[model samples]
Target chain A: MREQFDIPEGVIYLDGNSLGAPPKHVAERVQEVVKHQWGNRLIRSWSEGWWEAPQRIGDRIGRLIGAAPGQVVVGDSTSVNVYKALMGAVKGTERTEIVCDESTFPTDGYIAQSVGELTGLKVRAARPSSLDLTEDTAVVLLNHVDYRTGALHDMKALTEQAHDVGTQVVWDLCHSAGVYPTQLDEIGVDYAVGCTYKFLNGGPGSPAFIYVPKHKQATFENPLSGWNGHRAPFAMEASYEPDPGIARARVGTPDILSMLALDAALDVWDGVDMKAHWARGMTLTSLFRSYIEQMTSLEVITPNTLPRGHQISVRCENPAGVMAELIARGVIGDHRPPDILRFGIAPLYIGEQEVKRAAEILAEIVN
Target chain B: MREQFDIPEGVIYLDGNSLGAPPKHVAERVQEVVKHQWGNRLIRSWSEGWWEAPQRIGDRIGRLIGAAPGQVVVGDSTSVNVYKALMGAVKGTERTEIVCDESTFPTDGYIAQSVGELTGLKVRAARPSSLDLTEDTAVVLLNHVDYRTGALHDMKALTEQAHDVGTQVVWDLCHSAGVYPTQLDEIGVDYAVGCTYKFLNGGPGSPAFIYVPKHKQATFENPLSGWNGHRAPFAMEASYEPDPGIARARVGTPDILSMLALDAALDVWDGVDMKAHWARGMTLTSLFRSYIEQMTSLEVITPNTLPRGHQISVRCENPAGVMAELIARGVIGDHRPPDILRFGIAPLYIGEQEVKRAAEILAEIVN
Candidate 1:
């Protein structure tokens, strides 16, 4: 698994949460797609393979997230997927409010606001721990892991509470999907969306995936209603009739080149145990946190009492300048503006020694 | 310029109008982007080059389409762009109808129907030649070339007619952009959108481009309001304040791999003249039509009295079988159901010899 990625020599990359390192086979795979499928086959490739890319690649992603075969399909960006899932959840409900949190990813909040404006619903933002899940709430948007603090939420517990109050839930898995084990179906989650560029190791701007439960497929109407979602996309129909299954979530022509890269990237996860992978991530994050706290006075924001996702965050003065110096010293972690410096522990390529060295370098910079 | 593409040997590819052959350099360019920019540079590539891709590549395309600098930006699919442009046009208008034609591409009509349903407007479909442009028409959606018939419309005349009746126009330039010299700015077109896979020779399912005139940028709002279009996208603002320029039309993380291919593909047009390219297209299309007419009894649906686009369509019995036979004989053209055989004449890689051979093959199959 460690040999599956192409991380550069002499650089410790702890930003897999931002952009995953490319899989080792991606360069050769992309060349074949461009030179053979596109160059030789031309338009015939649509029927040959390109047309089925979104759903086929999506099913592979489904396996990692515990979704059924027909429950997840990949297309569009995560922002667009959030809008689709939010709209699909609230379409015919009598409820008048969309509930999200201030700690959610900013794009998710922005999408909620835009969808609320379009559907004439009130968008209410509350603290994550203090959300009042009520009957009037049409949808609750929750992040599986907070992007800035790496704080993991209790997804099953929150979902059960929302269900008790008769409200649907839409989860943003951008920070949790590939590295964390998500039992979406077993947990009875209604809708989930995640980007592939992060821990999934898809290249920059690869298409995002959305998960809808089996029962909700028939009623899911993606508001972006492009032709790809039509019942007979090639039939040249004048009216729009959405496809019946997860394919209905598709909004436009598949970006075949990027989709194919993601398909190849999924090969690295062939037979690994996700539970074991999650254990490794926890061990690595816990080790990094303790090493840093013992060496420096920086405030670690990640909560240690609860199990979290694959990253650790710290607050230091002049965080941006500190991160620049760390990168110059070959320790590559990213800084979110204002005060936070974040490091991701990708279980696939990152190991214990790399985490130890990264912590040592961070202490040297801050002190 | 024909030497620049990687069309297969012994195959006369007349389907560039459907999917353009990959430029010879695209394979190398895609590998560099995946391996170095994405794999080596990691997250830094977003700020280094990916941030400006949509606008920078758009300017290159603008040079070919006669659009001024900062007038075009590329992202999303053609279907998505159509939805964005149509929604942006009718946002504040008092009129309540979207006028299109029955002969327009089916996706454009479907998008119009969807937008109308969302915005409470009636989508009226009339014949292209007899479109009733009145005060009730909020926006007119017109295709520059009929997808099935290869019939080119008089853009300047139709635009002036729409403006005379006080309605704005949105043009679908999918079939006419790279091969035809479109004066979008000169014609005062309000909005335009097109795909890059055809005459632009971007790879399969590459991101599409949208053009908004300089004067219309401030007021335009893409209904798919993703954070990428925010005024300061990295600011992570919760409220949606659109970017003040053509960037407002963008709506998500761009597919950098495909976008970079399109960026390199646009380099093929650096020193070429579009007017000269359009002239060559007319010559090849006219020759193919004459050769087919002299040898076969198929009914040519393309009109000779009017200047048409980069292809010719012929009506024959069992078009699917005819196209199969033609492809078996190494002359590749696509079939649009019911009864049409369509052959594309891309001036970049297609020339007189390929056109003559394709016509002879079609004649032999249909005679």
Candidate 2:
């Protein structure tokens, strides 16, 4: 990497998949918001660019994921935005079947379930390996990458298949967007959502983004519609009239401080090539896999030949114990339930040397 | 008055109703989080302390509002929390009539209408002054202070009235909570929501606070049930199980930086008596009203006899023009459409002296 981040040293930190290391420039940006914009400018800050942050950041993120400007907005959490996207899909369709994978992040499925329960639709789950779009399915929801296994889904093919069956798709790109050149537009993604705390590294619990294809913006009215989404928010009007663009997806006031932090994080991504980044990440993971696969009883859960994203996982007898022990040994990946330790290979910070060292440490532990 | 804020020397700020000035200590707090907690701690910050900020800062706010330790939480915007509180209220009641004031903040009415439209219920716009609580009402939502008029509603009496009709009550405490001793339990409020940016001085667009009376926590669930609300969020389980107590109101990852700023803001309020705070605000507002009513065409829109909140508005033929002119002259207040310039008397940093001087300056413009 050309520029250094504020990521911790002396530990092989692999949990950027959970919370990305803070950018070095975020402090100066937050200082500007706290000092000049809010302290001195005060209410004028609303007019001075505060009001447009959701759409502005959304557009910046849109460039990475192939979404057009005005078709995406950055605000709220990933789960909340998924609710909006799923509700938009369900309300627009005549059928009531919403389909997803049983092994995807449970919140995505749980939120889909909540949307169905609250709005009177049926939520169905299938194993990711066999999730074929049925004729009765009005909408399909899927995580672009599995959190436990780092398994990449076939976004373009699955979306096309679902569309052919007359079902709209809502992709949870929480893991896929930051590390890859996601062709969401080329794949005809109807709606999508993702978090910033991951590879995009806005910070822990940072605001997430949502993308609705420009073709669907006018017709899609996902219904947590608050005043910020009002056509004229300052009018103090009584009725809920949504703005014409993707700004309508905004549910409440943008968290200005966190938005500034996320914006600064994007500065690190300005001129990066996604292809090179993902290759660098996968190369490091491959070396680690070779060093440890036969050394221990750990079974690599991630598909070896398929197009997996950067992070790799190993299924073990006691994954949480291994993860905790690794952390105690100064290697920081995460544990997912019964038997998966997800080691995130973030090329932005982690390099070849660190990956080799972490592999040696893990091999020692298992032995 | 002796300590100089980072505000511009010539500016007489009166728009705290929309967005509060940053505390002098916030910049330091932001630096610490961005550099040490987020940058240094990285992902472990969640386990280290970041995850508890919403509740920890919430308890600090509870002290100001006379709430018990576990009733309050800080996250999301005020409008979204209004939706969560309303959904929680409806879930507690089987019959689905939501009775609310049309005069409440437009966000409150919007949420009621949204719940009606999204979940298939009857949302009635009750004439708040009529005190007519009908038999079928499931919930009554009211702003403790009218946003435009600053007319304070009798929280205790109204909540009692709603209870008599077998209806739960939700309080929109945005305008009243921080400025006054908001004894939510004393008023028997089942659920309440408020913003921190105004009288609490938590910077612009800060995260808001939601109060779910511990007694009612078991009867309902937050509508935006994202994973953060799950009892075992890290388990990767496939079911929708909510965390017990008030934590269930939390739907997604919190904005830790924003919540931290709010925490620093609450630090300034540690020794404050909220009743005394309100007395000072009303006293200063009374001075402005007494002065503005004496000269030229300024007509006070807010009733003095009623227990008003922080803000006081006055009428003029071209209020927006005058407001713009006032901004030029460095006295900051907002003008509503048609005829009102709203002067919010924030007692945390304002008192009788500034109020008297501001009124004198206003009278000069009128004359």
Candidate 3:
């Protein structure tokens, strides 16, 4: 698995939570797409395979996230998809309020705020546990794992709460998607959006995917109704008629070059067991966290619980400076503002030795 | 310039207006980006160059489109950008109507309808020339070149008319950009959105760009305000405070691989004169249209007058069949509904010989 990635020599990269390391074959796949498909085949390539890539690659992502076929489609940035899910969720309902996790990745909260203004719904921010999921709460946007603290949330429990109050839930899976298995279908979640670049390792800023289950497809009123979502897109009709399936959530032309790269990246998950991989992630994080606690005086912010996410964060003095010093010594991690350092544990390529090496470097920097 | 592209040996691809051919060097550039920048550099790639790519590549695209630096930023799909331009242009106004070109590419009309529904404004579809620009019109969305008919519109006159009514104007340059020069800055165009894949020679479905001029930057209110548009995006602030420049038009993480591919593709424009290239386009279109008329009974729909776009549409019986036969004979052109067969003459890589040869093949297919 380590040989599958092209991690640089002596560079212990712990920033997979920000941007994942690329698979070695992605370079070749991208070249083939650029030269053979796009360059040689040209427009005919769209019909050849490019036209349905959003749904095709989306289903591949669906396999990892516990979604069956025809429920997810990929394109657009996470911010745009967040806007789509929130706006599409509340289209026909009489709900007057949108609740969002106060600690969500800032983009989700920002888009929810804009959707609130557009739909004339009041926006409220609260912790995931304390969300006041009344009948008037149109939707609640939650991050599966906190970006800054790497804190995992109870998706099944919170979703049941929202459903009990007759409200909807939209999950931001940016930090959680490929790290562990999520039962999106079993829970019957209303909408889910996640980035492919993080733990999914789909290169930088690859397009995000949105899940609109089969039951919800018929009435999903996409606000950004581009022609790609139109039933007969090639007919080029003046009026907008959305496709009857999950593709109705699609907006605009699929970013082919980026999308196919993600398709290639998903090949890594074909034979790996997500549950076992998640257990390995726990082992690596526990090893790294225990080393830090014993060797340094930093306060580990990530909770020491049974079901934590793939990363660990610690509060320290002058985190930016400490991160730079660590990076200077070939330990690559990132610092959030104010004073926290985050280290992502990607189980596919990262292992026990790399974790101990990174912890040793961190201990050296602090001492 | 034709040698700079990897056009297949026998295929006379006349669909560059739909999807441009890839440049010869884009394959190598994309490989380097995917392998070295993303694979080895990891998260450090953002600060190295990815953080500013939207604006950096935007300036390069600006040179070809007659926009000065700092007025253009690139990301997202053209449909998404159209929504942004329309919504951002209509904010802080008392006008109650948005007039869109009646025959726009369907996505533009669809997005305008969605924006109309969201903003509580009346969306009226009218021809570019016959638009009744009244004081109540907030903005008029016009296509610089008609996608189906290849008829070019008067940007200067229509923009003046809209200004006369104290209304803003948003231009969809999907068909016109990179084929000719658009005086967006000189015309004081309010806002513009255009795709990069066509004549700009970005890869298929590369991210589109939006131009918000310096004067309008302060008041531009982006409806899909995401964290990327935040004043301090890295600060991870909860509130959305738009960057006080063209970047306010950006949403979400920059699609790095696709955008950098576009950046590499723009290198083809380095030594080319856009005005001279547009003249050559007129020449090629004229030759193709004349040859078709001389040898076949096809009724050409593109005007025979000056200032036409790069495409020439002809009405033929069984257009789908005719286009298929033409493609089978190595002459690649596309067809629209009922009877329109569209041939796009890209001046950058296409020339007199390919146009004449394509016309000869078309004559054989029809006769």
Candidate lDDT (C-alpha), each: 0.88, 0.83, 0.92
lDDT of 2 at B267: 73
**Fnat of every candidate, listed in order:** 0.70, 0.77, 0.87
How do the candidates rank by TM-score, highest first? 3, 1, 2
Chain A TM-scores, one per candidate?
Answer: 0.98, 0.96, 0.99
- Across B15-92, the per-residue lDDT of candidate 1 in tens digits comes to 988888888998999999999998889988988989999999999999888899999999998888998899889987
Tens digit of lDDT per residue, candidate 2, span B251-286? 789988888888887777777777777888878888
lDDT, model 1, position B81:
91
Looking at model 2, residue B188 earns an lDDT score of 73
lDDT of 2 by residue, A1-367 (tens): 6256876667888888888877778888888888888888989998899889899999989888878778889998898898899988888467868898777888898788888887777888986667777788988898999888888988888888888988898998888877878888888899999998898889878899999887888888867878888888878788888888888899888888888889888888888887777777778878778867756657787878657777879877777777778888989988888777888888888887878888888888887
- Output the TM-score of candidate 2: 0.97
> Candidates 1 and 3: which is better by DockQ?
3
Q: Which stretches of candidate 3 lie over 4 Å from their true place?
A: none
DockQ for all models: 0.74, 0.76, 0.88
CAPRI band of model 1?
medium
By lDDT: ranked, best first:
3, 1, 2
Report the C-alpha lDDT of model 1 over A1-367, residue by residue, as the tens digit: 8888998899999999988899899899999999999988878889998898888888898889888788899988898899889989998889999999778878888888877877789999977798897889999999999999998888899999899999999999999988778899999999999999998988899999999888999888777788888889877777889898888888777788888998899899888778888889999999999999898888999888566889999998888899999999998888876789999889999999999999899988888
Worst lDDT window (10 residues) for model 2 chain B? Answer: B1-10
